[model samples]
Target: MRELLITWGDGGGELAGRLVRELRAAVREGRLVAGERLPASRVLAAQLGVSRGVVVEAYEQLAAEGYLVGRQGSGTRVAAGVADGGARPPARVVETEPRYDLKPGTPDLGMFPRAAWAGAVRRALQGAENRDLGYRDPAGLPQLRRELAAYLGRVRAVVAEPERVMAINGVGQGLALLVQVLARRGRPRIAVEDPGSPGTLALLRAHGVRPIGVPVDEEGLRVGELAASGAQAVLVTPAHQYPTGVVLSARRRTELAAWARAGGLVVEDDYDAEFRYDREPLGAVQGLAPERTVYLGSLSKTLAPGLRLGWAVLPGRLAEDFRQAKQYADLGTGAIDQLAFAALLESGGYDRHLRTVRPRYRARRDALAEALRTHLPQARLQGVAAGLHLYADLPADTDEQAVADAAARRGVRVATVGPGRLAPGGPALALGCAGLPEQRLREAAALLGEAVREAGGTVREAGGAVRDVGGLGGAVS
Candidate 1:
């Protein structure tokens, strides 16, 4: 092992200051990684031929500032959150090995095109005017709006003009804006798919919008039930429905369009529609009647979630109200990010990156499916037509939560659709195949199978509960 090189300070006023700077530089350069115990004060003093008290004082200053975490037995290890000075703790402990993270709704960050992104940022900065730095449009930069309008037209068949497109932080904020607009119309009750995204459902409720649960089936949202609930607005993920990946059937799509045309409004969340592998891409329901549908799409899946960039194509009637809502929300998304994304779209970089990573994700998805088949032949799979994650049905006797707990104990993280249920005992586990490396994906699936077996149930075989074409099991869980 290489030894830490410490230089002695002078007796002058600047000596201690120089030493602190050197020490900080060493840590910043990763000469000291987290958890590596530092030398004792006496040892460091002797090595540097300095007074022991000096070393001790330096260590004390760092500890007080949260740079070093010290314990009687643990010595001084690097502490995370040093910059925040203990305002936040470290993130949840995640297993390092087996690297498979099948958690749902995240894209493979490893596949993020760093070079292209950097290029876009550089180009944007170079062309940016001094006035561009000012807090400008709250509805996003004009260039990005135009680029997105063009892109959405081709991909989602959205009838988006730049004027109708409003860029906001993300889906969460987009939903919030819609809630405010609908609230103005006295439409407080919103219908969500049964077993829909919990975070989204809660966000609506927090904003004083009541969300009623409507059942989703192979044909997608139950339109008749949606009407019966007396909800004036509804959120539907039509392209590849969340958790189940079911495409809204043609008949149902028409029925929904009719429903919207008659009176109600639709919030069509086009989440994860780009990653469909099986059939041809389905045009958004918004395309049929842009006047009745409020279309929401985001880069959280296609690019990365941290970007906080998403767009909503509102109908002409609701356009003015939605734009005003955005103005009061966050003054639009940051201008720099909007320009960067617009460059990404105009340059064709975003689609290129997607083409590159799609095969890699496809491979990981296949690995997960094969692992399920080999390890637990009886488990049924569902919703693999398109999307980052898929679902599997556990036997009725199996405790889905217990299996999730057991998997976590073995350093695996898998989720269940049952917990997302508006009712109890949904009997399914939602497993995401994205973000994890192939090896980890296989291991996680195998661990899940073991977890199911330990929970005292077996997956059914060939004639069992297969639902979608990609071996996604039953959604009735």
Candidate 2:
């Protein structure tokens, strides 16, 4: 048919053979539906600028393959069941677009340094050798590794060498590979913060690693509970805890390092460590216990998650195994992107970008905090010292899920802490401040306050008992 696409330049196959392939593809791909008649051989030949005999040959072959049926009077038509076999599932219905997306773990994507990054990309490509385009060391390009080692050391206080770093797709891949390595080493169980990342839990589960949930307090993951859990390894976001956004206290950091030093392993996810507001900068725990820590960092929050650029600084003992895992898992990350990021880091463009956006994100965070205080006066906010999202503990009587649903109905989307909790916890919401502007965040907070008020009464009347409300520290009202 005229609608069918055929590529004549797809190699040395005969025209009729190519026609057969195209027509077969069209039928299999649902382009030629069941009972749909194709043009006459002569007509199709004219339309395709081919000989009539070629068209006839293709038609004959397809007909014999049961893709078409022909009769003396009715001419050619698609076979009755052909299209059903090739039919695709209907597309998923997209959810309603929320007025404000307060979902955590996302940055203000519009602030990405497009020009600077583009320049870095251009320079990287121009400076790259022909061999650079081919498969590189699974650990990463030496240039990028060297740059990362220097950058991490100077910025995050991570004790890393180029040999100890392996470029990964993101923290997700790094974690997955580490899980696989641990499994091989007979350590398949890792302790995670109870109110930790649900995505992290799911990822660990997918990799066949059992995640033990340890409670998190204002000081961050409870080292006492983690030690009691008997998990040989632990995954933590020390710089800024997710959902809660609490930093690991100095005391807890010391205890954690001691635990790791005593035959334990720590996997530190240094996500969103770049944006610190209203607090003195705390270096990564890996800096304290590099020999027992696998420090993971990514550009997901700083630049864009779409870039999928990240690195893992592994302990010397695990470096070679992790490198092999990385080699087997997609043969290292994209070279061009790696080189581009390296150039950006070396040129200090990355630091400049962080400096530029830090103030803007801080402003948004301040606006959200102020709006929440003004609107939901009774709600206690926690972990606002650093990171893009703040944890808001709802009134004991409030229903967080109901509030989230009410906010969604009001065109504002927010995440509840239920999905992330391994044990029972009081109702709370994690509101992201980086995605929207200050004005929008204020508006969203107001709407959220209204939703909380509307949902509060219903939950109170239901007599739902609050559970596991002890560990989280005193509210910062």
| TM-scores, each model vs. reference | 0.77, 0.85
What tens digits encode model 2's per-residue C-alpha lDDT throughout 1-477?
346666666577799988888777777778888888888989889988889999998889888988888989888888877665667758899856678988877888999999999999999999999999998898899999999999999988999999998999998899888888887888656899888776787687888877799999989999999999998999888888887888899999999999999999999988888888776579999999999999998898889889998999999999999999999989989999999999999899999999999999999999999999999988999884778788899988777878887888898878777677888778888888888999999999999889988898556335454332112211100
Clashing pairs in 2: none
Clashes found in each candidate (C-alpha, N, C closer than 3 A): 11, 0
lDDT of 2 at 284: 93
180, model 1: CA deviation in Å?
1.8
Q: Report the poorest 10 consecutive residues by lDDT, candidate 2.
A: 468-477
The 10 consecutive residues of candidate 1 with the worst lDDT sum are 468-477
lDDT of 1 by residue, 1-477 (tens): 347775554645554455566666556556666666788878877887778888777887777766677899877776653333223335699846433445677888877788999999988888888766787777778888899999999987899999999998888888888888888887667888887775675677789976788999889999999999998888888887877767899999999999999988999988888887876688999988899999998888877888888999989999999989998877678888888888889899998988888888788888888899888777787774577887787777766666766677677766667535564435676777878877878877788778778876543343333221112221111
Q: Candidate 2: where are CA atoms >4 Å away?
A: 1-40, 46-82, 85-89, 92-95, 460-477
Give all candidates' CA lDDT scores: 0.77, 0.85
In candidate 2, clashing pairs total 0
Deviation (Å) of 252 in candidate 1: 0.8
